[model samples]
Target chain A: MKHYQAWCFDLDGTVYRGETAIPEAVRLIGQLRDSGSRIFFITNNSALTPQMQAEKLMRMGIRAAPEEIMTSSIATAGYLAGQYGRMDVTMIGEEGLREALEEAGHRIVTEGGEAVVVGIDRQISYDKLAAACLAVSAGAPFIATNGDLAFPDERGLVPGNGAFAGLIGSVTGVQPVVIGKPESHMIAEIARKQGLRKDGMILVGDNYETDIKAGLRFGIDTLHVDTGVTRKEALAGHSEQPTYSLRSLSEWEI
Target chain B: MKHYQAWCFDLDGTVYRGETAIPEAVRLIGQLRDSGSRIFFITNNSALTPQMQAEKLMRMGIRAAPEEIMTSSIATAGYLAGQYGRMDVTMIGEEGLREALEEAGHRIVTEGGEAVVVGIDRQISYDKLAAACLAVSAGAPFIATNGDLAFPDERGLVPGNGAFAGLIGSVTGVQPVVIGKPESHMIAEIARKQGLRKDGMILVGDNYETDIKAGLRFGIDTLHVDTGVTRKEALAGHSEQPTYSLRSLSEWEI
Candidate 1:
């Protein structure tokens, strides 16, 4: 029942699932925009660029600018830039992660570097993993875009970036610094970049583990909708409860 | 030291490190062969076939027949053969694993098989991993050739087959049945194939964790050398010690 200055929404299960957009979520987002609330689309997908995500949202009748999207790739780049400034980075990811890192003034290399950043790479090879292991074992800072082990596809659940990062961690005996929920790096990046206070921001998502936990960790209010991953019945299992839990975004009044 | 009917030697570190053979080990193995002891080369490297391993040993002055070499690939195949007879297998590995599985009467497939077998594959791709993850998530049995997380290469320690298997495991929440040194499957295979009793077998290696532990778990005598991993000083940390520890193979009397 409280109005927030910024409404951060998780993209995958909150706004859309695969190719189709949730009508209730789309309608709610439009109402929030009309009410003069800042909208941010946050996602753990490091494969697609902000422009690509915005285009997808536009096709679903949701107006979103590239600057309004905060993907894990962008958050990873921003986190690295803030932590160590611009330096050589060994990267294992798709075009989005590469572009984000390069845009942040970090040089990508094949082997030794100041940091080893990993994301979901569909074209992942053994050589790339070997190089990452070697670099991480050599004491380079290891960073992962997200820690999702498996994600759903048309066929079934498939290996995600977190699985690959876990492999590297097992081999090198080093843990990577994760940049996605529920670590709160992306939420912090959004707050810092937009000059918004955590008290004035509310994260709305369907997943309790990633989205809701992220908001709680970042000291922001969370609204959980039972449209995706976590069902309404599963909320009782978690010790920490979200600020608001609704069956759908349609139940929320602007 | 008592003479045994069978002498099982671990390939890397015990007999040879990289390309060079340990002179003391080579001399002792020759003496053991002359003394009419059955010699077996046991290795967790699933990349190389038994014939290739035998040839490598032969070139190092240790005469070994293909039947005398028991690789993790061969052990895995043998294990699968005994457990399920002949079944369609989804494989993610190199030539050795493929050959061994096929030779054991199992048909290799890309996905949706009775089981999923993984090994050290330098040509590993994300698609292959995705397929394996899907298969395992679909309720197929997951098997790994070895569980060595990292192995030393020319540059440094690189990700091993276990790392990739662990990745798939993380994605599917399935623990792979490892057929390698620490598990005693390879040693069990040698004993079953040769009709040798556990009392008549003695495992020789430098690594206490894998080699010695395999021998101990298999109820056989174990000889640990200090020429490779698990230094003599470090052996004190382990609760279960090897049957015998020596500075070199030259210390053993024929």
Candidate 2:
């Protein structure tokens, strides 16, 4: 029932599932944009570039600029830049993560590095994992883009970036600093980058553990929708309730 | 010192470390073989084929037949064969694992398998991992050749089969049946294959955790040599001690 200056929407379940876009979410997002609210698309998918994400949104008739997208890869890069400035990094990820690191002025190396960053790499090889383990064991700062163990594909849930990071952590006896949902790094990065106040920003998502928890930890109001991972009935299981829970975004008042 | 009918020696730290052979271990193995004791070389390495391992031992002046080597890969194949009786399996591993599975009459499929097997694969790819995850999550039995998280190479400790299996397990939320040292499966398989009794068998190794624990759990006499992972001083840390502890194999009387 409350109007927010900034509206952060989760992809996948909130806006689209696979290739299909939710009409209710699309309508709500359009209404929010028309009402002069800043729109941000936040996702834990580190494999795709912001441009690629924006293109996906565009396909669903949702207009979003590449700059408006805050992927875990971008957040990881921003977080690393803020903490250690430019770093010599060793990475295990796709083009998106590599681009983000490069854009943040970090040099990517094969073996020894100042930081070891891992993301979802579909082309992941044993050599890449071995290099990451060696670097992390050598005391380099280990950073993971996200901690998602699995994500749904056409067939079923497949291994995510967290699994790869977990493997490296298990081998090296080192826990990586996760930079995705349920940690609030992405929300904080969005707030800091846009110079937005937490009180004026709200996160809308379908996942309770990731989206709602992220918003709560970042001190922002979270609106939970039932279009994705978590259902409305599942909300009763969590002690910490979201600011608002709706069956669909169509139920929300602009 | 009591003489055993069967002498099972762990490679790597026991017989050799890297490329060089441990002189005392080589002499002791020779003496044990000449005394008509059944000689077996047990290792958790699933990447190298039995023939390759035998060749490595031969290079160190220790003659070993391919059939005498009982690697985790062979044990895993044996375990699966006994449990499921030759299944269509999906796997993430290299030559050794493939050979064992094929030799055991199990068909290796890309997806939709009755079982899923994992091992240390230097050529590991994301597609292979994803397929394994899909199969395991779809209710296929998950098996790991070994649970050694990290193994020593020239550079340092790198990710092992356990790390890779851990990745898949984390994604699928399924624990794999490990067939390696410290689990006693390899020892059990060797016993079954050679028709040897536990009372007549003695396991010799440099690592207290893997070697000694395997022998102990398998109900056999264990001799721990202070040549590799667990030092003699560190043996006091474990509440369950090895049956015999020696500074080296040279300390043992024939």
Q: Which ten residues in a row have the lowest lDDT in candidate 1 chain B?
A: B55-64
Alpha-carbon RMSD to native, per candidate: 1.4, 1.4
Candidate 2 residue-wise lDDT, B1-254, digit = tens: 78899999999888898888999998998888888888999999888899999998999888899989999999999999999899999988889999999999999998788999999888889899999999999999999998888888888989988888898989989999999988899889988988899999999988887899999999999999999888999999999988999999999888
lDDT (tens digit, per residue) of candidate 1 on A65-164: 9999999999999999999999899999999999899999999998788899999999888889989988898888999999999998899999989999
lDDT of 1: 0.92
Give residue A220's error in model 1 in angstroms.
1.5
Q: Pick the candidate with the highest DockQ.
A: 2
| Model 2, C-alpha of A244: deviation from truth (Å) | 1.3
Show model 2 residue runs off by greater than 4 Å: none
Q: Among all windows of ten consecutive residues in candidate 1 chain A, which has the lowest summed lDDT? A: A11-20
- Fraction of true inter-chain Cα contacts (below 8 Å) kept per model? 0.92, 0.89
